[model samples]
Target chain A: MTGPLGALRASAVLAIAALATLLQVSLAPHLAWRGVGPDLALLVVVAAGLAWGAHSGLLLGFGAGVVLDLVPPADHLVGRWALALMVVGYVAGRVRADLRPDRRPALGTIVATAAACSFVGTSVFALSGLVLGDATTGVGGLLGVILASVVWDVALAVLLVPVLLRALARLEPEHAR
Target chain B: MTVLDLRPRSPEPPERPGRPGPGGRDDARRPREGRRRPVRLPRPATGRGWGDDREPTPPRSLVVALVLAAASLMALDAAGALAPVRGAVAAVAGPAESAVSAVARPLTAAPDWVRSQGALRDDVARLRSENDALRGRLAAAPYASNRLREYDGLSRLTGRLGYAVVPAHVVGIGPAQSFADTVTLDAGSAAGLRPDLTVVNAQGLVGRVLSVTRSTATVLLVTDADSVVGGRVGTTMDVGTLRGRGEVGPHGLLDLELVDRDATPARDDAVVTWGSQGRGPYVAGVPIGRVTKVVSSVRETAQRAEIEPYVDFGALDLVGVVVPDGTRGDRGVIEADGTLVPGEAR
Candidate 1:
């Protein structure tokens, strides 16, 4: 993928990923229920996995997770997110391969993967907080956050998948090899 | 001719007897000639050729690359080399963030509009309730006239302290999960703010300055668990140490440990910083809070009192940082009667 057209597609994907991450960070907080916001970055990682396959998704997930860990108010060890998100991306990619390329299956995969990713991400975060003995860490809050995040992520997936996929399709050719 | 050749036959040598004629010799040479013919070689291998023998060790290379990448990331994170990278990322992200906000602005605005419509109704109801509450306060004002007079006296005392009051705005709030309970103020080093400067608001003591950049500073709110302030309680003249007990509600509960076990603390006794002879970070006579509950134990050397901070940490907006003149020495002064003295002019 070295031609001008390939470069365009790559840039588009990068831009989309960045945009999605920003939106997730800023907007998701507003939708928070009981101090648990939706993990939009996780959803984006899952979507990337579905679109591009395992290798790209894992790499992208790792990078995005590092970025998330660097944001304000982060207390957990840095690489913790990197490892968890890589697993999420890889698993989402495998699941994507099994699903049909049709619109319904694509949407379904996005929603399901978003929920799974959120569960894994939040659990890892909560466990890290507990290990660090952070003052705000509480078992009840962790469970509440995980549950709320899953629901929020799933909802976002339902709305964002088609729009993202269509945008991606426009950037790439009709036939993908 | 046949009669003359009948008696002329003789034996031939063994080496030459079986020699083939010219035609037979030619046949024997055919196979040898075929072996001597030049053989044609296969075509040169192209870079993309299928039969190329030099295969890449893909798994080994990938593993090595991954390990190297991980090591580099860990090193960068540990050494804080990623700080500039993170800043660059934040810069780039700013525009992307704006673009995202622009696209989602309409969706976000709709909710605000809906919320405003709901707020209108809420506002009318709130006003009606407030009117009723004000009427009740007006009726009770006569009975509470003495309390108001006391507050007026306190305000006048604060004014006479000769402290130049500078009002600063709260620009940003730290996340609730943060253990530090810090807030960023718009004021910075340029605004006469220095580390360990005591911050207060209209209610009482707020916090102290932690770090200052050119245009901003991080203030560690007094509600943080780690914060400890040397203070004294009211005109009863008891010396105590005040420590934050984390976030319990709108106002943090300060644990006051008085130096004298025999000291009797009254309810609503004022708490002020135990200023060092005009040289501590906090100035004396700054109202910290009031004693809420007192715990007395005969075995313990010091009595403990629970203090309710006057400052509402949740709704904190404007604050004042006491800028001590000259040296950053101890500014607190303790009087002979055990009460904290107000600001001492250097």
Candidate 2:
């Protein structure tokens, strides 16, 4: 996975990440349910980890998180998303590598993994924000935000994860054959 | 199709030692080219955990190193060293965000359109708006003469103040990406906007420009929890601090803490901004909101109240950025009774 094809695949991942960050900043705000929107960027990173292995997940997560941090109107600390997503990707890849290594993941498995990762990523972000200071949400509000983020991510995972898996799979068809 | 085994399948046929089975797909077989590794990866040792192409341990160290880098970035950003770096990123990402926001603007309005799509309510709403506009016209008819008499004062006032406004629109509002309340404006440094400039809608004070890129600016709304503005009660003239509660609508409120120990703040009292020192961030005498509820501190002498903002942040559209015009030097302040107070605001 380290040749020209690999480079092409990595760029494709970055493009998807850029698109996710764009939508998260522009369109997601309007789609927000009860002041909580779906975390498209985070979900995409989870998909990367699940589709690729742990190394790919870690790299893509950091890159995507930076875009999210710098998107217009973003006010959180620059590296908060990067850290949260990096951890999320590593864990997601491990889930695929361990537990159910050889077989393709079912839709139910994908959704469950996404929900779990969403919870972990959001909690890490919130906790880090509190530690770093400048966080606005109190403990009670942070809990509500996390719950909402999980729900939104799971609902979207039903559609997004499978599509992402297929796309990533296409990048390595030569190896697969 | 073989690559994606989405459906449940039975286990593959067990392979013999020296030679692989006919399919040889799931087994530890190298690629035909021999230069490339198999996509599904050479299967790990017996009793190894699931389907990944590579071992997972390397990623563990990568995660730790990246996390440390993130922590250092947070520290640098907190200490205010990342402004230029952030600006550079925004310079690249701002236009894309603005373009997408503009393109998807109708999508944002789609919810309301769908809600109003019912034929009966659509007609009713349209007629109501038309009726309101006509009624507004008729009501203004009686004030025509009054408006004419005030025109002289308005012209003089404009001439004296001389600070013109640059019109802009809100391009985006945040959700999960940002924890605080912020919006992206369609205008930025090219429009002569800088940080600390006041943003206002026709209703009242909206926010202040927090950061500016070449073509876009981010405004920190008055409804963010970290936001604090100097405010005063209209009737009592008791100066106090008004803080945003990080929400919108009836539930989201601005907290007003009065400075005077004995100041009695009442419900329905009007609140306005007490201008910043240099007439930036906030200008004097802009309507902010009305007090919805008042709660006096039992322990502390300072009284508190809740304010419902006049501007509907959810539906913000057109806005004005107050930029000081620095031509025709020494334009004095406009006070009542045709008196000029010499613009000494610094």
Candidate 3:
């Protein structure tokens, strides 16, 4: 599915995804509010999806999700996040596809997509865990995760997405870009 | 036809005033009736093809295949079929994580280090002079009785309580992802650290070992909402069940529900762990916390109170895990005199 140039881009995307996951898992607690931190890995996947399109998004999200699943203290079914993040990537890609970047308000689009991703990703995870009888969070806890995550991601996207888009654009072949 | 084509076309017709621009705004001209009106123009075509420059959506089959793959992996992991795979991954990731934590720890403590640098130097200079004076005193005192007395007291205490203890350092804390109250210890199964081993620090009980890997083990903090420890009041010796209240504010608090209905534990009463059945999970006589507030009950049989834990869950560094020896026979309960005794005799 990937050519030589495409593979390079994918590798770069994957590296960023892994670093984001590590930061989220390790350092984010120090900056948490009420026991919730922004999901940096989710932001990276969403950005990749929007900038590179659905295929790139799906692949990045899946790989990042798998890495998160394998990380210690995960203590849940592997690939649970993989499934949720994949959906987030696809939806973000579709939104980007519908409204060409040149025609849309850049910051508004990024914020909206990030907010949607956080909400959808968290809801899917909580609901699936509940169905599988593995989740301990109640409705209030689920709500807190969604609310806190969306607020944090949107704030971060305003600064992060534009920079990420520039980097991603450099990775794309000149002709394709 | 050639003569007509050779003739120059009449000068291009002059454009009318007030013609609108490409942006749909027009030049304004005064009407004959004295009212000004702006004329609007139709938009010119850019000639770019719609959706031609855009990347096409990925094939539906690709998405479905990926989803199926993810679902299958999830199912396998949930069924515990992927334990070996998970373990292999952890074995690699755990050490890398620990190394990262080791580097990050200093950075986090940078402020404290900076603050103490000046004081530390002064203290070192002062201690050097004091050491010289102390050496003189030591030389003059041929028989130092303080050291011998201290060792005698230590030996007596250890002899009274037969506890196999292994000291370990706290390596890392709960990640931000789950916000769980847990700590990773440097020692694991290699050091005889099995799951359910009781861990404590200098102050009081820390928590129990939840899981152990080859090189590290994760301890579940007593401050975790899921943790429950059997506790007793210091003065009244009233037994109660102690539970973590999660992070209520700056730190975590414990709630105690006394088993004895008539026992009213007062403020400042020390709480200690009621011994585990076989010295598993928790050991007897470990200080848990001090009572801050006592809530009286009229309708209910049990009394409740809030406990401020002795150990600071936020700043744990070094800890000790009590490893039990099976030969100790049946574990004893804490007597009113604060001594361990056979439960039957009590």
Fnat: each model in turn: 0.07, 0.58, 0.30
Clashing pairs in 3: none
Q: TM-score for model 3?
A: 0.44
Error of 3 at A69 (Å): 1.1
The better-scoring model by DockQ among 1 and 2 is 2
Model 1, residue B116: C-alpha shift (Å): 4.8
Q: What local lDDT does model 1 show for residue B272?
A: 87
| Residues B137-227, model 1: lDDT tens digits | 9987864674454334334434644354334567888887765688998877666567887777767788888988866878887778888
lDDT of 1 by residue, A1-177 (tens): 221224665556556655656876666555567767767667767766666555555665666677665544444445556655665666665665565433324566677777877788678667755764632757987787788878887887898766665555554443332
Tell me which of candidates 2 and 3 scores higher on DockQ.
2
Off by over 4 Å in 3: A3-5, A101-105, A175-177, B1-55, B102-346
- The sequence of per-residue lDDT tens digits that candidate 2 reaches over residues B1-346 is 3334421222433234457645565453543443243244334334323234645544345667788888888888888888898898889888998999899989987886777678668799999999999999999885665444443433343344344555567888877346688889887777677898877766677888899997688998898988888999999899999999886442357999998978878889999888875886787777789998888757977888999988778767666666665411122322333333443332
- Please give, for residues A28-80, the per-residue lDDT of candidate 2 as tens digits: 98889898999998888888888776777877788788777777678988889
Which lDDT value does model 2 have at B121? 87
Q: Report, for every candidate in turn, its global Cα lDDT versus the true structure.
A: 0.64, 0.75, 0.72
Docking class of 3: incorrect
Pitting candidate 1 against candidate 3, the one with the higher TM-score is 3
Q: Is candidate 1 or candidate 2 better by lDDT?
A: 2
TM-score of each: 0.42, 0.48, 0.44
Q: Give lDDT: candidate 2, residue A49.
A: 84
- All candidates in order of DockQ, best leading: 2, 3, 1
- Interface RMSDs of all predictions? 13.4, 5.0, 7.4
